[model samples]
Target: MTTSPTTISVPADHVLVWSDEFANDGLPDATKWVHETGRNKEGWYNNEKQYYSGPRLENAQVHNGVLTITARKESNSDQTDWGGQAYSSTRLATLGKKDWTYGFFDIRAKLPCGKGTWPAIWMVGSRGAWPAGGELDIMEWVGSKPERMFSTVHTTAGSGGNGKGADAPIADACNTFHNYQMYWTAQQVIFAVDGKVHFIYKNPGTGVDAWPFDAPQFMILNVAIGGDLGGAVDDAVFPVQMDVEYVRIYQKSK
Candidate 1:
């Protein structure tokens, strides 16, 4: 069963706290991003599977002021020796160098649509580890359902240890560039797409197991190949790319 949407009260007075306009042409600001390497020992957590590793530009690049993450078919020569797979791509994240607690995070981008393509803008806390620290899937979509996007939060207690949080779906998420955003506070987290509110969850009133979002969190962006959620990747659809225009963050005025 799904949980009902919680009430979200946007403060009347707000100001921009942080933002990345991507005004620089060709290449993301290295000062703000650190590429993630190595494969997940258990594979990507969403039951959706993919082996992520590599230094290939075909997997990631910034050109003409846009960041692109492309997934393509290549020989084992292009793949990193993570586990076993010839396909390779890059995953970028701001883990140790930067982190934020409560604020509004927004990403503007156009998605890649094709069978077995998965792209996401998400976050993980900088605390202990994994679901224990907390995870927020701000925007994740499977190409098979290009019309809908999912927003969800995972914590130690609800991450199968207890149960996963509810999911809210948004329509027409791939055809156009839209702002996928999340507003997080000490008590709750609210998710929206293109400025339209979709889902909100209040603090479950337990412990860190139930609410581990009150800590520093970093951002992640990637385009993943078929494994689980993305279904079987169509061999012909390789070289698929995800285009990101900008990422912006705003905090409540102190």
Candidate 2:
């Protein structure tokens, strides 16, 4: 289910703050990304089955000006992961490498359509623990729901699958490139795709429990396998990928 698309217009005075165009064909720029390894103790917080690998070309790579995060069905008997699922993938973040308080973020990508695949471009506060700080899911797509995409925000007041969110139906997301964007300010967080606003969350000014995005936050990108929301897996689409053309950040000109 998706709502009617809304028009989005950027403010005139804005400056690029950071970006990765993935020009060279090879591993991602180390200076800009930090790879996450092992499934967190809580299994990535959603029982996600894929083993998140670090610095592996098979899982994360850049080629022909595009960054690819691939999820492959395989075994990792040496490591412990939820369900011990025989699959591997990549999770990239800018946790300590880079972070921002408020800015406009744009990522152009082509999603993967493998059943049970869950791809996301999101952010988490760099300060405190999960939910206590805050989280912003700029874009998320579940393979089971091929035509729907989501944008959500989580805080102490609301988090997880039940977090505040909105959806948009994009029938060709898997085969076509689309801009997943976000404009964040102290007043509100606006989420859009290809210039269409799909979701918005206004700061209540109540406190951290409701609005904990005042602090710095870092970006994250990953693809997971069958989990709470990812329902069931289909072995047929073993090696799937989410292609990212570029990621850019912008701030209001000073």
Candidate 3:
């Protein structure tokens, strides 16, 4: 069962350090986000089909106080993807422009419904490689399963199919907006949806392999089309989207 927190408000003592309110319409704030382009050698590491496009309006855009990441069933003639599939999407990250060590990260968004859509709001350590650097998946939802959402943490010792993860049932996640949040510190990592805490990964304090999140990490937002976890694609869904209202981060009072 998920443990609900007493309150969802940012603690009175904490101060907002950074935020992207999407005040203006158009491309995302270049000062805060950069798009990860092309298809990875490992099919985006999960046999994903979509060819991640550049910073274009079709895939990534901000409008009317919301950031919309649209995934489309279209071909990318310029790039060669592993799946040989005709689809395109966007993966935006704050790698070098904005990376933080530990803080309270919060995002309010609505997921896309229909098979083949895999939307995620997650983070990764800024140093080392995958597994070694660590990953914190704040929110992950595959369209195949509309009633549940997942959270997971990956480390060198526990990664790939062996990662420590859990899920919570949220029946209307695709139609409603929810606060996907993470509270990280030197001691533990807590994952929550709205105000309810669903999972916690405690630092073993053994070595980097078990807890490689001691360093800085960056945020990532994307909507993948048909992957190992996304199952089959319902091309009829066509241009679906994950609508993000805002992203904010807070730190303890200084």
Instruction: Please give, for residues 195-254, the per-residue lDDT of candidate 3 as tens digits.
Output: 788888888899898998889899999998886899899999989999999999998888
lDDT of 3 at 213: 82
RMSD in angstroms, all models?
A: 3.6, 3.2, 2.6
Write down the TM-score of every candidate: 0.86, 0.94, 0.93
Candidate 2 per-residue lDDT over residues 1-254, each given as its tens digit: 54433766566787899999999989889999998874543466577888887788999999999999999988766665444557888899997899998888999999988789999999999999999889999999999999999999999999986699899889999999999999999988999999889888989899999899899999999998888877699989979999999999998988
Q: Rank the candidates by TM-score, best first.
A: 2, 3, 1
lDDT string, candidate 1, 57-116, tens digits? 566677777888877666454333444454556688876667899888879988887888
Better of 1 and 2 by lDDT: 2
Would you list the clashing residue pairs of candidate 1? 48-228, 48-229, 49-227, 49-228, 72-239, 158-163
> What is the lDDT for 33 in model 1?
77
What lDDT does each candidate get? Answer: 0.74, 0.88, 0.88
Which 10 consecutive positions of candidate 2 have the poorest summed lDDT? 1-10
The runs of at least 3 residues in candidate 1 whose Cα sits more than 4 Å from the true structure, single-residue gaps closed, are: 1-12, 40-56, 76-82, 160-171
lDDT of model 2 at residue 209?
A: 96
